[model samples]
Structure formats: C-alpha cells, structure tokens
Target: MLHFLPAPLRGLIGATLLALNTLACCVPLFSVTLLKICLPFPAAQRLCRWLMDFIHEAWISCNKVWMNLLGNTQWQVEGLQGLDYQHSYLVTSNHQSWVDILVLQYLLNRRVRPLKFFLKQELIWVPVIGLCWWALGFPFMKRYSKAYLAKHPEKKGKDLQTTRRTCAKFSQTSVGIFNFLEGTRHTPAKHAAQQSPFKHLLKPKAGGIAFVLDAMGEQLHSIVNVTIHYPQGNPGFWDILSGNVDEVVVRFKELPIPAEFIGRNYDQDEAYRLQFQQWVNQLWLEKDAELSELKQRFPGH
Candidate 1:
C-alpha cells in the first residue's frame, strides 16, 4: 500500500489513474456500441452487449488495482452466496455518501450480473463518459416535478411508461438493476430538515423501486437488499482518494418478490400503492436498526 505518501499526492495519482482507465475502456465500448447499432440483428446485438460487459468489468478491475495500490481500506462484506451472473436482480441499497457507489462496484463487480444504474436523462449528454454509459445500456430517466405534472395533467405516469419501455429491453438479458432506496444521501441535517423517523436513514422513496418492480417484476430473480456502513463514518470520493477511509461493512440479503407484485400497476391501483409503501417502510425500519447495530459492533481497526 502507498499509505506512506502524502494524502493529496495520493489523491492526485488516484484520480489520474482512474481517468486513464475510463478513457482506455470507452474506446472499445463505443466501437462495439456502433457495431451493435449497425448490425441490427438480435444475435449481433447480444454479442455486442457481451463484449461491452467484458470491457466494463475490465474497467472496474483496473479501478480495483488502483484502489489496492493507493490505500489499505479494509472491506468487510457478506451474504454474496447463491448469486448468479446469468440471472437478473433488483439491487437496492441505502444512500450514505458518494463512496457508496465505489464500495458497491468494487465488491460486487463479478459476483453478480453487471449493475446498470438508472441515470438522469440529462446525464446522457455529459461527454465521453455519458456515451460510455449509454453504450453499456444504462437506462436514462427523465423525471417530472410535481408542479410540472400538475400543470400538464396529460403527462401523468410518463416516468413509469418510460421505465416500462426501458425494462422491457432488459428482459431479454440478465442484468443487475441498481436503485438507491433513499433518493438522496442521508445526513444529520437532512434527517432533521425532513423530520425523518428513522435514526440512521432518510425517508425511503417507494415510487422508484415500485416502478422497477411494476415494469419487470417477473423477469427479476429476486431483490438484492444491501446495507453499507462505513465504520469510519461516511466519506466523500476525495476521502477514498486521500486514503482516509478505514473500513467498510456491507451486508446483502436476497428477498423474493411477491407473486402478486408481478405485473401490478402501481400508478393505477391505489391499494397496491399503499401496500407497496408499507413494504418499503418496513424495509427502511429494518435497515435503520442494522445501521445502529453495525455502529456498535464494527468500530474501526
């Protein structure tokens, strides 16, 4: 480990290494994406996705190398058994910090199907990396605010419709679709501002995961419920680069989606919507307790 180096220097080295890795991987990613579009055959498209996944994993593997060389952050993870790379999973987790994304990708890269996150529609236009995300089949979501929806009543359920369309394409292939249940990162200020009930989490948003299940519930093998706790406390992306992160605890459980939930219309059915909200609330309640326990049990080494 390069722990002896000054942290700012390590951070600069880490950033440069990761940027180079991403640029290296994006070239082949775009090439295969173009090949897939030109061919237009199912067989050819499948081949392109496979090739892209290989490239995607390689990029992540390179990041792992840089992470190992930069610092000595300990990873404590469990409940990864029985996961199949060939099966689709709805992976849900609590939001803490930007570091959560790195921890998830670092630990769960090849253990499950490649994770495709739901991105904001505007992100598609970002630049080189935006196209790389598109090439990897990340679903870009355009969300409408309540005020906008109220002004244009005709646009109701549009987000759900878009999700349904995107998920339909995923049905043909195995993927790990990830969503952060807490829409935003949790912080003491945010918790107090929102008057959140849970001690260690923000309010769990039901609409996001409900929409995912409504669209592709039957195709998904199970819900990969994940909890990530940083015993050193939540840290930003810079903390990772600066070698400040000491330890991370991750726990996962595979929960079966109820048969009745398959193909349910969340927007149209009021009763189902209430039931789903209750279910999500219960999950957040448990996760909050888990975080409380991890804090007590897993102090930093």
Candidate 2:
C-alpha cells in the first residue's frame, strides 16, 4: 500500500491519483454531453442519468483511493441515509474550507441529482466548468445590493422572479439545492467582524434560503441541516492531499417543511420573512452548540 511510502512519496502519489480522477471524470462527462445533444428525449435523459451515476461512482473511488494512499485525512459521514432522492430538498451546511465542496459532492451526489448550487450570474462564463454546471441545471442568481435596490425600487423583486423562473423549468425531477447560509467560508476574523450571535458560524443570510423556499417550497419536502467538523484543523486542498489533515465529521438532520414556509412572499411579507429568519436562527444555534462540543473533542491546529 502507498500508506507505507515516505511522506513526500505519498504526496506525489496523492497528486497523481487526483490527476487521474479528473481525467477519469472527463470521459463520462463528454459522453453524456454528446448523448444529450444527439439522442431523443427519454433516451437522452436516461444516458445523462447514467453519466451522473458514473461520475458519482468515480468520485467515491477517487476519494477512497486518495485517502488510503495518503493516510492522513479520514472522513466520517452520519445521517447520509436521511437524504431522499424522490423528494425535493434544500440542503444547508456551514461553510469552512474548499474541502467542504468535495465533502458535499462525496455525500450528496447520486442521491440528490448532483447538488446544484446558487451562483452569482457572472460565474456562468467560467469556461467549461461553468457550461457543465449550467447543463446540470445549477441556478445563477443576480444579487442586487441594498444601495442599488433603494435607487431603483422597482427592481427589488426581480431577482426572486428570476429564481422562480429558473427553478420552475425543471418540472419532472427532484433537485437538491445546496446553500452555505453563512454566505462565506467561516473564519475567526469573519465571525468577529460580523459580530455574529452564533458562536461557531458567521451571520446567516436568510435571503438565499428564503428565496429558494419562496420559489420552490411546494415541491420541497425537507431541509437537510448539515454540520461539518474538522478535527485536526481546517486545511487547504493541498494540506488534505499532503497527509496533513486529521479527520472530518459530517452530520445531517432532516427537518420537515413547515406549512407557513410554503407559498410565502419572502421579499414583501416582513412577518413571514422574520418568522423564516427565526427558524434559520434556531438551527444555527443548535449547530453552534454542536461545534462547541466538537471543538472540545477535536481541538484545533
């Protein structure tokens, strides 16, 4: 096994495996695109679904290979079975490192239609990856600043309209909408600057989740509240591959879709919006407590 190799040698092997993983994923991706464009309706859909399955399988295989070869980072996922592919879901997770994305892809893939993320409208032009994301049905949002909204008051609800239109197009399939409610990666400095009420997370941005709920709440079955912990430390991507990380613990808790949350106007109804914000605030509080306990157990770098 590569685990017994010298540390430097192990890192080389890890890098090699990562390269192979990327190369391996491309073949199926290209094949799916070709089939999607050339094939008929149900046939194309079937082929695309198969490609998604292949990608998810490759992801697992690559993660397993990298972890075993490097032997420093380990992953533990709880409540993975809580995800239901048959129903729509809004998955919220606390952001920490780029590793969070990989961890998400590892856990949520196949079970959840490839985990569509909300992106800024500009990300639609990031070359091949951007095109792939669009093809896979990720939502691109145009966020307006408060200052701009005040100047052009009529434009206030336009973003929500855009979101609703985009999400409405997928009539038949259930999708997993993933958002990091903290809005950015968590850091001690960001936490302090934001003066967050929660001890562990930065301030939660309710607008994103509220918009999704407003646009697609009827189809949404549950909210997947996920908490991720880095026991060794929050490491960068290279740190993970170089056998520097200790372990990652991820927890998922599925909460039912509240009746009041459905069909609410998140932009216009202050009372409904406040009620939703409070609901998210309570989840962050529980996550804060969990993070505290986890920090005590894991400590940090």
Candidate 3:
C-alpha cells in the first residue's frame, strides 16, 4: 500500500482520511441528538435505533473506503450462523487493540444491534464520540475505589445500583453488550505490570461482568464468546491500513444462559461468585492456548 508514495506522504494521507471520517460521523450524531429532544419517548427510542444502525453503516463504509484507498486488503469474516437478531447476547472477548472494536463491528453489524459497551463515566466527556455513545444508549458507569467506599459506607453499592437501573432500562429489542474481560488492551509492559496469570491476557475482571449479569440476567438469552487471533501479533491502525497485518481468525461460540445463574447475588454470595470466576478463567485459558498455536503457525505474519 502506497509502496509508490513516500512514507511521509502516506502518513499525511492517512491523517487526512481520519479527519474526513470524523467529520462525516458528526452528521448523524447531531441529527440523533436533535431528534431525541424533539420526539416523544417511544418515538425517540425508535429513532435512536435507526440512528445507531445508520452510524454503524457509515462506520463500515469508512473502514472499506480507507482500506481501499490505501490498498486492496482482503477482509475475512466467519462463524456467523443461526445468530438470532431478536435475542439479547452478552459478547465477551479478549482485548488487544482499538482495531478489535472495528473487527467486531464489521462482523456483527447486521447480525445484531450495534454493541452497547459499558463505559467509564469519564468517557462521557470525550469530544464527539462520547456524545454519540450516550445518544446510542451506552451506559456510562462509575466504579468506586475501595478507599472511597471505606470512607463513605453509604456510597458502597450506589454505583452498581445505578448501573443496574440504567442497564435495566436499556431497550431490549435485540442487542449485544461487549465486554473486554481483560479490562484494557494488551501490551507487554501492562501485562508485566499486572503480573497476569495467563500468557495471552491480563487477569479477568469479574466485577464488570458481575455487574452486567446481575443487571440484565433475565433478559440475556446467550453469550457470544468470541476468540480473536491476529496471527502475527496485535497490529496498530496503520499496520492494518498499510497491509502489514495478516490474518485475523475469529471463532464464535454461543453459550446458553444457565437457569441457575439468572438474578443470582453477585456480591453477597461468595460461593456463587467463586464459581463464576472459575468459569471465566477457564475461558481465558483456552483462548490463550489457541492464540499461542496460531502465533506459532504464522510466525512471520
């Protein structure tokens, strides 16, 4: 890609493309905000759904346009079969790069409603993207630190309750809740800092999933557990655009929501919590092993 264009020119062009895409994304966001203010609650909800679909469509278009402009990189997706668009799913995956978001979006766009991520409260302040996420019905959450909780005992379960209420009110017209079990993108330094127990990812964060399961357990029909492998290793956005990235293998396994797990106490019940943690850790172990094998086979990818 741009093997003909000098490195400086290629970088400049990529920057221009990013700017253009950002500008284009703002149109739908502004439109949705205005519609929400003007319409009735029920009408506004329908409009929001349409707006999210439109935004995702535009995002896919942007990805295709940019990749084509830089080079003709082939994109591959698989394992989408019998995915009911009318059912609610909890999507869990390993986090590696920002690119992970796009890969998931591209694969599951029409397959399900665009994913509603559980975001940190402060992300609400991020420029355009923040506002769009809010308008699209993503729940912004605030986690209390242990020290803060100790100081203000009254505030102990407040955040979790707030999250539960917010998420419980979320529209149930078929959607995916995406969670990065590792909590953050994977990097050698960060992984070392955490002294992770697994080879491929940081330790699983149970609190986040626990909150989600507690809040939306009755509505959740299945778990869309995805395993993503970037054959060589994780790649930056530029690596993807420059055709330096090789294969991205994705495996999808749907797990049924257990009857016993529904609406169970995640915090007070130590035994149940331990059992849930063990199940999540087993998933990470299998993912780590799969990624290791893929890396070995595509050593230079």
TM-score of every candidate: 0.97, 0.86, 0.88
Window of ten residues with lowest summed lDDT in model 2: 52-61
TM-score, candidate 1, is: 0.97
Q: List model 1 lDDT by residue over 192-264, tens digit each.
A: 9989999999998888779999888988999999999998778989988777788889999999998888888
lDDT of 3 at 185: 91
lDDT of 2: 0.78
Query: Candidate 1: misplaced stretches above 4 Å?
Result: none
Comparing 1 and 3 on lDDT, the stronger one? 1
In model 1, which residue pairs have backbone atoms overlapping below 3 Å? none
- Best-fitting candidate, scored by TM-score: 1
lDDT of each: 0.88, 0.78, 0.76
What C-alpha root-mean-square deviation, in Å, does candidate 3 show against the real structure? 2.5
lDDT of 1: 0.88
Per-residue alpha-carbon lDDT of model 2 for 1-301, expressed as tens digits? Answer: 4556676777777777876776667667767877777876975686676676567556556776676567755667788885767777889899999878877876776677657788888998986567656666678887889899899999888878877887785545677788889888999999899888888789899988888888888888899999999887687877656666677888888999898888788888999989988998988999999989878876665
lDDT of 1 at 251: 96
Give the backbone clash total of model 2. 0
Superposition TM-score, candidate 3 onto the true structure = 0.88
Measured on C-alpha atoms, candidate 3 has an lDDT of 0.76
Ranking by lDDT: 1, 2, 3
Candidate 3 residue-wise lDDT at 207: 68
